[model samples]
Target chain A: MVKAVINGIPIEVEEGVTILDAARKAQINIPTLCKHPDLTSSASCGICVVKLKKNNRMFRACCTPIEEGMEIITHDPEIIEIRRTVVELILSNHPNDCLKCGRNNNCELQKLVADFGIREEHFDKFVRDIPKDSSTGTIVLEASKCIKCGRCVDVCQNMQDVWALSFLERGIHTRISPAGDIKLADSPCVRCGQCSEHCPTGAIFEFDETSKVWEGLMDPEKYCVVQIAPAVRVSIGESFGFQPGVNLTKKTYALLRRLGFKAVFDTSFGADVTIMEEASEFVERFVHKKGTLPLITTCCPAWVDFMEKFHPDMIDHFSSCKSPHEIMGVLSKTYFAREKKIDPEKVFMVSIMPCTAKKYEITRTDEMFASGYQDIDVVLTTRELARMVKQAGLDFAQLPEEEPDHVLGDYTGGGVIFGATGGVMEAALRTAYYLVTEKQFPKVEFENVRGLKGVKETSIKIDDTKVNIAIAHGLSNVEYVLNKIREAKKNNQPMPYHFIEVMACPGGCVGGGGQPYGVTDAIRTLRSKGLYAHDDAMKLRCSHDNPFVQKLYNEFLGKPLGKRSHELLHTDYKARPVYRK
Target chain B: METSVVPDIANVVEKWKDKKGNLIMILHEIQNQYGYVPREISFQLSKLLDVPLARIYEVLTFYNYFKLKPPGKYTVSVCMGTACYLKGAPELLEELHHILGIKEGETTKDGMFQLEIVRCLGCCGLAPVVKIGNKIYGGLKRSDIVNLLSQYSKEGAPVAQPV
Candidate 1:
């Protein structure tokens, strides 16, 4: 342990702990812009500098390790002045139109400027004239607002292993862009939006589509309906001043009704249906040997895009089931519209998702149009939903708890847990075990396939049959899993596992690229715990036990993977070139 | 979009295939052979190295030396060193720009001459020097640029050696 005195508060921390962390332990606030809890510190911003008494040298607290007996003055008059100057310099290059920015009041740099009492620009304003790139249609690249923090680049290249973004030039000329100065849509971007999630400013953000939803809502002819994803229920509370893990599922349904939606549904219901289709598919493949082993889940659109581009060879292994929201969209248009005697063309379906990639997934293939119209008309991120709620002048916290529309809103514990990493595997296994052994498993909860680990491996036995399963989240962690499979295939070795799940974001949808900002592991765990807690409190914990899903299957779709289910619930994949021609 | 690799570039890739820091080394070889890196070659290299095209472009763009396009047949380098700048080199550069119809580091429309601003050519004594191809012209006036460039523009013109 290393002992340090931060602002006269003596604290002891681990040897390799940064001074910033040490000061944090001592309750000394050292402001940082470039350093995020989820990313390694690049120390690009000078705001976290602290004064050392022993050597009398100012060091960047974020990157410097705390030494024994080191007297660190994290906040002195001189240090404040220096930090204030740094903020001013950053402001000089940044556009002062904060109100027009998407980040606006939530920007870290803006927060620092306000905290430092910066009233005016001290230096001449010299903002770059880079035009925004919205080619991907999922995230926008407003390069002019970037402060060269390197967080987005780090997340994109190192964390995600999607080298679609990089520091193209050097020094003042340096800007984050795709390799070859190509449009992001043409680049190997997977539309994951992690870059936007990691960005400290509005330089990277989800392409706002709230106005489009408003247009649909205001149109008297359009029957606008909205559905909330499983992750959004736990995550959207952060924007309304609630803790990260607070479940606001009921409140959100009430809030959406207040916003003038004709009907509100739950994507968890769609997740339950997905499990019905996916679990049966697994049984058909694993039991009957009809398809390839190690059926990789394709619920996360980002993971699907990544597979289509990087690991196209594994296309055969990917499950043909559509994502939960997409399933909800198609069903809402076809079944809901037909049952209610409403025109399918007038049914404008919007999905409130914790993912930016869902925006792209809505129109990914012809299967998305299986309802004879665009299944999902609009997709709003959890952050965007928060904005829409605020715009509607509704106090989300004070909203009365309510239930979703009964026809397609009810969900099971298996459905709700789909928000977290290894959740889909657990959910699938619950139903797959039943499908295989013709009996409900003794324990519904699979403890092994849980948590924020990048790669999770476990095996479950159904009677005498042992089923090997592997779950991986975050795109970078996927390479290791793929390589192992590749090596086995090359050497004619036995297949590693019977099932695999991949979510592009680290902690699944809870840590999605479009969730509330300032997300760390603590926040992700809390948000995931919220879903798990919701699961535990539920009476029906398995997907097959979801009565509404069973009702849908009985009333409309004959059975899982039947002609009707195949038409609406399942989709296909094709190999795609990473870059545009 | 051309997936077919040139034999020369393939040879270059094979030569540096086993070595570390081979990307830059192979890029240097390609640049030397073709005078500048081509888009097609970069695509081929990206496929050969199993590296992302963005990574190769990042490295190519970061360094001032690498060029992404083919250079002109002749390069007209105006020395912009302190000595040359003090000796009316800017006017000489302007004259060349006017005559060639191209900016610094850009080739002419006809692909005949490329204009560039260079630093000290180790001939400070001969300030306001202009180097065209291998030959250096010292003590030059703004008016002399048009005449000097005309000598290289004509088809099958005999180029003078360095003096």
Candidate 2:
């Protein structure tokens, strides 16, 4: 234990706890720019300066540990003046066009400047002339706005293991870019958007495509339909005044309808259908030995991109099923268009996703065009939808709840939980158990495969077979799980797992790169809790019990992996160069 | 001829693989051999060391010593230290730039001479010194820049010059 006094207030905390954390425990909030709750502090920004009374030496509270019985002065007139000077220096290099900036009012630096009452430019303005790079078509890199926080670099290289964004050069000339200063589209980016999620400013952000959707909606010849992903329902409420974990599934459907969509479907319905095919594929792979063991999930597009780039050797182990949104897109174009007697060409399918990678996934391959046209015409992120709701002059919190269009709206609890980490494994297991035992899986919930653990390994017994499962979220966690599989293959040992689920973002789609900003693990857990709460409250917990999913299988597609299902709901993977050029 | 001589990148990586700070050390070796770190060599080292190519570029670019492009046959170094600056070094540098048709840190079209403005060469007594390759010509006059450059442009010229 360590006892410390912060700002003359006595406090005690465990040893090795940073002075910033110790002060936080005592309700003393120290201002920080380079420090994030989700990342290690690099102490690049000199904002969190504190003085020790013993020697009167200054220290960065973020990186300096709180010494036992130490007297620390966190905030004072002198410190405030120093902090103000630091902000002024940062502003000198920063652009003055905040009103036109993407981050605008939401930027941390902007907030800090306002808080410090920086009304005048103290230092000479010397903003860099670096041009913006939007070559990825998923995220933009505005180097001029970068404050050298190192958060995006950490998120890209350390957390996601994508190594797309890097700090090149040094000192004042230091700038973040893909290796060799190549276009991000040519780099090993994977279009995950985690870098944008971790970025404190508009230096990195999702590519805004809201105007394209608006143009399509106004076109009289086009029949625009939209669907909301499972994670979008839980985390979208943060943009409004609601709590982090509040479920606004019905309200979002209502909002999309108000925005002039002809039909609003649920991506959870697509998730249920994905479960049907994926579970049956697991049965074929695990029981019949028709395919390789450890069938990996392909629902997260960022994970799909990473697998294609980094781990193409495991392509045979990858499940061929398309993601839920793509399934909904194809169904919206082919089945929904036929049922409503509308022209398929005029049907523009837009998916509201909690992912930037989905923007890339819409046109990943020819399989996305299985409906004879682009299955999904436009993809809006959850953050984009929030902006659209505000732009329409609609009171999102006060909007009346409305149900989705019945054809593809209804979903089971298994489908809704696909938003969280280890969710797909649990959802697939529920249906896979039923397929194997020829009976319903009594205990639908698998608590072992839950939470924000980096890698979760568990096994379930179905009649005679013991199925080993591994669920890994975040791209860095994947390498460990993959190494085990690779080692087993090399050694000619037994298979390590029968099933594996991977989500590129930290806590699956709930913490997606496209979700509301200012996300920490606490927020991720709350958003996940929202989905799990919805799952617990529902009557039909298992995916196979979804009446609409059964109706789709019976009415159009025959069996799980039948000709129509294979054509529309399944896709293939190919090895790709990490660097395009 | 330069393109035909592809040095073994594997041999360089193998030499530094067992050492600490190997990435930076290996990059130094590459810069020493090639006069600049090539993109193809960076890719090869990235695979050999199991490090990301982005990280290698970060190291390559952070240090000003490493160059990304091929250097010319001869380097024209103009000392810009306090002594040299006071002794008409700026005029000498301008004369070289005009004659070579290139600015500091740039090579000429024919790839014969590259211009660079360096700090102190530890020869303050011989202020306004201009060095070309291994030979140093001290107390240089701006008017003598044409004669100095022409002497190096000719092949099989004397490598040493009177200081």
Q: Candidate 1 overall Cα lDDT vs. reference?
A: 0.91
Residue A354's C-alpha lDDT in candidate 2?
94
Task: Judge candidate 1 at residue A334 and give its lDDT.
Answer: 86
Number of the top-ranking candidate, with DockQ as the measure? 1
Kindly list the per-residue Cα lDDT of model 2 for residues A7-78, writing each as its tens digit. 788998999999999998878888999898888889999999999888879999999999889999988898
Identify the runs in model 2 with alpha carbons over 4 angstroms from their true place: B1-5, B83-113, B121-163
DockQ values, each candidate: 0.68, 0.54
Q: Compared with the true structure, what per-residue lDDT tens digits does model 1 show for residues A185-265?
A: 998999989988989999999999999999999999999899999999998989989999999999999999999998999
Clashing pairs in 1: A179-B54
Residue-level error in angstroms, candidate 1, position A213:
0.8
User: TM-score, chain A, per candidate?
Assistant: 0.99, 0.99
Model 1 has fnat of 0.89
Q: Candidate 1, after superposition: displacement of residue A575 in Å?
A: 0.9
lDDT of 2 at A140: 92
TM-score of 1: 0.95
